[model samples]
Target: MSSNLTAHHYGITVADLDRAIEFYRDVLGLDVLDRFAVSGPAFADAVGVDGATGGFAHLDAGSARVELVEYEPEGDDADAGAVNRPGATHLGLAVEDVEAFHEGLPSDIETISDPRTTESGATILFVRDPEGNLIELIEA
Candidate 1:
C-alpha cells in the first residue's frame, strides 16, 4: 500500500530571500523552523536544478508550513510570477479571529473580500499578501 501524500507545506518562490523572511517572520507571526542553505546533489535533482545556491527558510504557521525558496538564478524552478500565473490560487490559513486579522491586515493590502459572518457563524476575510498572493483569513 502506498502512503498518503501529505501536503506538508506550501512552497513559495521569492525574489528576495532576506526580505521575504522578514515579511513572513516579522510581519507575520509564523515561527521560523529553520533557515539555511541547502546542500548535496539530491536537492538539485529534486528541484530539477543542478547545484542550487542561496538560502531557504521554513516557517511553521498553525498545522501547515510555508517554504521560502531563494535561488541564485542559476537553474531555479520558480518563476518570479508565482502569484501572477493564470491559474494560481491563494493559500488559505485559518486564524483564531477574523476580526483581529482584518484589523491586522496592512492598509496597503487590497481587500478582496471584507469580513462577513458566514451562515455557519464563522467570519471570513480575503486579502492579498505583499507578493500578491491571495490569503483567506478564516475565523473559527
Candidate 2:
C-alpha cells in the first residue's frame, strides 16, 4: 500500500449542521456523499478528543470531498477562532462561472474575493462560509 496521504478528505467543524448542509449542498451545489454517526474506536470519540458529537456530512465537490462535522454544544456555540484558526483552512472547488458563483453566494458568506490568476496558471477566487471556513473557488 502507498504511504502517501494525498488528502483523502478535508474535514471541518461547523456550528449548525443544517446550515452547513444548505451551504455545501444548495449553495456550493455539492452532492451529499454520506452522513453517518462516528463511533467505536474512532479518535474523535476518545477522551481529550477535540471534535463534535453530531454526525458528519460528506459532500463531494468535484474530485475533492469535504467532511463537515459540528460539535453538539447545548446552545449558541461556535468555534471562537474561525478560518484563521489553527486547524481551519480553505477547501477549493472548481466552478464554471466564477463571477456568478461569487455573486449568487449566500448572504451568510463571510467573505468573497475577485478573481485572481494563480501562479499555477489558473483563475481563482476566495470565499468563506458562515462559519468562516475558506473555500477557494477555481474557474473551470
Candidate 3:
C-alpha cells in the first residue's frame, strides 16, 4: 500500500493570483496549464477555511506541477511569520547552478540565506515569494 504514491502537485495559497502567476510563469518558466475558480463547501473543507472562494492556477514546471491558490484572505494584513511553525511547508526547485540562480533572482525577493553546500554536496538557498511563501532552490 505504500508504493503507489506519486506526487502530482504542491498547492500554495497566495495573496494575489496574478502576481504569483507572473512569478511562477515568467520568472520561474513554468507554463500555465489552467486557470480556475474554486468555492463552496468542498473547497472550504479541503483548505480548512470557512469559505474559500478565489482563483486557482495550475503551473507546470517541467517535471512538476504546482497549484497556485489565491484564497480570500481572512485575517488582517500581516507578514508571513516563521517557517518553523507547525504546518509550514516549502517547495524545493531543482536548478543547474544554485549560485548563478541566486544571483539572478530579483532584487526585491526576500532571500533567507545565500547558496551553501550541504554535507550531501547539494547546493541550496531559500527565498520567499511575493506572498512570503518559502521556496528552496537546490542545484541539480
Query: Which candidate number would show the highest lDDT if scored against the true structure?
Result: 3
TM-score of model 1 (CA atoms): 0.76
Every model's TM-score: 0.76, 0.72, 0.83
Off by over 4 Å in 1: 74-86, 118-121
| 1-140: candidate 2 lDDT, tens digit per residue | 76865666787788778898988888889899898866444645662355535578988865667988876532454454555677556787888877777778767676655777767877877877767777888885
Full candidate order by TM-score, most accurate first? 3, 1, 2
Cα deviation in Å at residue 105, candidate 3?
1.4
**Which residues of candidate 3, in runs, are more than 4 Å off?**
1-3, 45-50, 73-79
**Where does model 2 exceed 4 Å of error?**
1-4, 40-47, 50-52, 73-88, 118-120
Q: How many angstroms is residue 115 displaced in model 2 relative to the true structure, after the best TM-score fit? A: 2.3
Q: What is the C-alpha lDDT profile of model 3 across 21-89, one tens digit per residue?
A: 998877676899999997889988887878768788999866768999777845455546677887778
Clashing pairs in 1: none
Winner by lDDT between candidate 3 and candidate 1: 3
Candidate 3, residue 55: how far the Cα is off, in Å: 0.8
lDDT (C-alpha) at residue 125 in model 2 = 76
